[model samples]
Target: MKLTILGSQSPYNTTGHNCPGFFIQDNQTRLMLDCGSGSHSLLNYPNDLQNLSIILTHLHRDHYNDIYNLQYSSFVFHNQKRIEKPINIFLPSTPAKIYEDILSEQNSFAKYQIIDENSSFKIGNMNISFCPTDHPVETYSIKVQNGNRTIVYTSDSSFSAKNRLVEFAKGADLLICESSLLKEHGFPEINSHLTSEQAGIIAKEAGVKGLILNHFWPEEPVQKYVDEAKKVFQNVIPAIEGLTINIPSIEKELDERS
Candidate 1:
């Protein structure tokens, strides 16, 4: 499978960066992880509108604002007969107001399904599952598996000893984790997000093959987040907008070859 960073900024979009969004594709499936602000403009449009599935971690504006744009695109495309079916969207059902708003506005262009920690489904060759995360709202961290390769996306979440995230993400080929702040920033006591170091700890404890850090605070230097994560886990990759990463790192590929 392939994971692409559509945008990595957090809270809001900035001068050259957009809010959190990611694109994942394998041979038979096309899935979008989030649709944050400014991410709509980066989508492949008519092409992506067809046979696409979306999953939202929570109702945070920065994580789902672009979904409105996608709704419009789906509407137009279906009207034009460019696509025969509505796009599938899987999202948390809590924070009732936001969920109701989305349901009310949803036309026949997109099919919305409620997802929780117990949710498990398949799309093409990919097997997808969810686990609740340490976030204020009903947030979930997602796991996608195709054959023996697995990828885990830890959406907005804070560090918690009781969080099932490490087990949910264990042995993943790639862990796309949110690192919303630098360690020096001193995460707020009522934390709902992870620092780069915290993200590294999760990666190390989970024993994931590789780590991709995302959900950046726009003001901080990207390299600083990477540097902090590398302290605990050396195989750290900073999430860059428009960069696509192949699962099963080159190391694994070499090992298989050997």
Candidate 2:
């Protein structure tokens, strides 16, 4: 499978990047994870808009605002036959207003699938599962598996209840974590986000093969986040816009050598 960082900025876009967004693709599936601010503009044609499946971890504006733009483009572009069908969106079912709003536009641009704390589903060659994270609203951390290779994304969560978080991400091939702040900045008031240190701790405890740190605060230096995470986990990759990573398959590697 391949992972693409469409955007990595935190609450909003910075000088060089957009807000949180990701594009993942394997042989048979293409999925978009989180459509935050500036994602729509970054997600232009021929590169990311064909037969896409979307997963919105929560309805927070920074994680979902670009969905409106996606909906609009889907309608306009499909009318011109640029796309064959409506996009599929798997999203949380709480915060009734957000769920309802998405459902209201289902027939037009998207097909909605309700995701909860314990929801599991399949798409193409991937097996996906959800775990409720420590966030104010109904938020979920997602795990995607294709055979033995697995990727976990910690959308937006606090450091308070990390046991479940660690277990959910255990043994993942890559952990796409949200490090919203530096350690010295202190935690968010609502305890809804993690600092770089906390993100690295989860990655280390979970024993993931690699860590891709993202969802950064715009004002801070990106290297600072990477440096903090590297202190705990050696294989740390900073999430940069348009950066693509291909997961190495052990079986494939063996076959090639033989």
Supply every candidate's count of residue pairs whose N, Cα or C atoms clash at under 3 angstroms.
0, 0
The lDDT for every candidate, in the order shown, is: 0.84, 0.82
> What's the TM-score of every candidate structure?
0.93, 0.91
Best by lDDT: 1
Candidate 2: residue 104 lDDT (0-100)? 83
Q: Taking the tens digit of each residue's C-alpha lDDT, what string does model 1 give over 76-120? A: 889999987788988898899998888787554999999988899
- Which of the numbered candidates is closest to the native, going by highest TM-score? 1
lDDT of 2 by residue, 1-258 (tens): 887788898788866688888888887578988998887675657435676889999989889988888887787778788788778888887889987887787435667888887788888888989888888898989999999889899999988758898999999988889998887786564367888888889999999877888998888888999888878877777788877677765334323322
